[model samples]
Target: MFDQLIAYLDSVRARDPAPRSRWEILLYPGVWALGFHRLAHWLFDGELYFLARFVNHLSRWLTAIDIHPGAKIGRNLFIDHGFTVIGETAEIGDNVTIYQCVTLGGTNPTNGVGGKRHPTLKDNVIIGSGAQIIGPIVVGERARVGANAVVTDDVPEGATMIGLKARSTLVPAETWLREFIPYGTPCDEPCEQGNGGVERVEALERELAELRAEVAALKEERQVPARSRKTGAAS
Candidate 1:
């Protein structure tokens, strides 16, 4: 158990640079939260729903992070900082790094039946702060979700997702091969101005040009009619 704890702390240290020592990492709210979650999940598995819920609420109160007792989390699932929420049916894989203010939220089924409604994060996935991953989507292995992205669809392996609607950005092989990326964003490239943004900008520009041409033609038509009426009146 001590060896496992050391390994977990080392994993967190690899992802985070702020921690000076394993002792410091141990004091982190994410670490404490994960510990409480383990107890809660154990209780939940034994059908002690009330005790599980009690532990979950206590963890939330202490750590400011809410992870449902029913959520299945794998080893070294690091939650950097706090204010993160994992839904009941959410499944997190090994070495998945989630930043502050992120949500692995579930979709509301119209039939109102309880099932797998939350997201599943594959191994080595990194989620940035304030990102919302909704629905029962699969975030593929080694995928990176940028800060403030809203994802509702399945992310492909090794892809980098960005923007409000969360469009995939092509990442260079060198960047993708890196061990870890801070904030799940590539510093070498502009994430917000991706291919999708460029295409949308071009489309909007084309539409604006077409509208301008139509407006000019209408003005010309009105001017011609007014000139003809003036000429007839003068004659």
Candidate 2:
């Protein structure tokens, strides 16, 4: 427990810009949430379900973060800000960072039987603020989910997931880690640009329009046939 607490503090200090003092880390909601989570998880595993849920409720009330005791989280998990929701069956790996208003929610509402409804975040995954990862998707290691992105499918390892459909920016995980970008922005690309398929279709349509205009101009500027010119001259 002491080792895990140290790792957690280290992660928070590394990521956040404020509160440089060790004492200040106590005030961080991320710390409180995870600290309580440890106890809650312990109780849950011991079959003390009621006590686990009660602890979870208390943590939520104090931290404004909702993490089900059933969610298995690893060391050095940093939940930046409050208002984060981690559902039951959501498994989080080590060194994962999640910003405020992020939801690891279920895609299927009617499936109340509750299998693995929430998503799994692999090690070193960073989910930006306001991002929603739905269903039992696996967010691969070192993947970045952009702010406001709605991810309904699995994300490839080392990819940057962005846009409404969660298209990858193709920036590798190493590059993303090296450069800390806000709002999960691409290291050097615009966020709102169309995806590969959309861009390809747009480019093809532009080229086709240009080709059609060229064909029409060539037909209009074509010279009269030699035979027709001679016949007209004879007439």
Candidate 3:
């Protein structure tokens, strides 16, 4: 009973939603989330459509957190910051940690009757800020996804995923975290923009787009205007 209580407390603490507030709002968010998770999980199992969506709508309204009712989350699933998103097909094991802005989505077509999207995280996995783990990949147990890493592939157990497309390597969480600055910027090369990789990638992507636009403009100007076929003149 004590173990169960401790597990529940851990679960609540892990998903604390209040930030920039004093002690008052600190623990309340987690309690609310616990109640919400319970409701959402129940709805998922029972496939109660209207009630599930209603509860999810209310939960998102009250909490910035948005977790699809179809997602199966195990015990001690803490969500810090509340901007975290878990897809409908997402399967979360026990003792998972999801920070703010973490996205577990599916790249599969989001068209009519959306296909199976969203990644599954096994037990004791920690997903950092802005990390995107998409597709039908499986993140192994005790895996730590670095802040802002974009992961689209399967992750092995006890691995640390970092950088664009998320490279898995054997590294300690403390060591990897130490390489990131306090403002969430990564100390590494490609991940230098935000304590994580996505920021840097976004920067690079913006620069590439600008360069492409410039090249296109130059090419357009170098070419002559459309020629009048009858007059044989370039206008």
Candidate 4:
């Protein structure tokens, strides 16, 4: 227990620029969530499922970070900021850094009774704020997911992923670790689409949807007339 506390403190001190003291670290959401998670995970492993859930609920209420008791999380996991969610079947490895509003969620909500639904993030992976890693995909060690990106496919080790489509560019994990990119990518890199560009695309998409609806209505109208003509011929 003493070692775990020290490790958690050390991890927070090393990763975060905010908290000045160990006392401050204790007040952080990540520390509180992880502290409760340890006890909850122990209860869950012992098959005390209801008790585990009760503990988890309390933790969520207090921290606003929801990490399921069933999730397999390793040491030095840093949940930066709050509102981070780690799903029931999600597997997280050691030294993972997750920013606020990140979700390691399940893609298929229905049909499957019990199986791995969420993603598996290997050691040293960094998930930026608002990133959603859905499905049973594997994010290999030292991979990075950019903010607001939605990743559906598996990410290779040392890869840097970005955008809504989750495009990846590979870099050696060692080299990536040596230099840190604050928001998962350098500031100089151009955005895939600016706000104006996005708005224009959205407008075009709406127009396209209206056109498709109009075409569908025409097709239905033509089919109805054909059926009526056949009925008249038979009569």
Point to the candidate with the largest TM-score.
1
The runs of at least 3 residues in candidate 1 whose Cα sits more than 4 Å from the true structure, single-residue gaps closed, are 189-235
Superposed on all Cα atoms, the candidates' RMSDs to the truth, in angstroms, are 7.4, 7.6, 11.3, 11.9
Best by lDDT: 1
Error of 3 at 172 (Å): 5.4
lDDT of 2 by residue, 1-235 (tens): 7776676687778877787776799798988999899899999999999999999999999999999999999878888899999998999998888999999997666856768789999988889999999999999997889999999989998788888978988765556666445545564644456586688679999999999999998776665476678899999
Clashes of each: 0, 0, 8, 0
Q: How far off is residue 101 in model 3, in Å? A: 0.8
User: 1 or 3, which is superior by lDDT?
Assistant: 1
RMSD over all Cα atoms, model 3: 11.3
In candidate 2, residue 172 scores what lDDT? 54
Q: Which ten residues in a row have the lowest lDDT in candidate 3?
A: 179-188
In angstroms, give how far residue 10 of model 2 lies from its true place: 1.7
Candidate 3 residues 175-217, lDDT tens each? 5544222212333343344455776668899999999999999
- TM accuracy, model 4: 0.75
Order of candidate numbers by lDDT, starting with the best? 1, 4, 2, 3
With a 3 Å backbone cut-off (N, CA, C), the pairs that clash in candidate 1 are none
Candidate 3 Cα outliers beyond 4 Å, as residue runs? 1-6, 10-31, 110-115, 172-235
TM agreement with the true structure for every prediction: 0.80, 0.75, 0.64, 0.75
lDDT of 1: 0.96
lDDT, candidate 4, equals 0.87
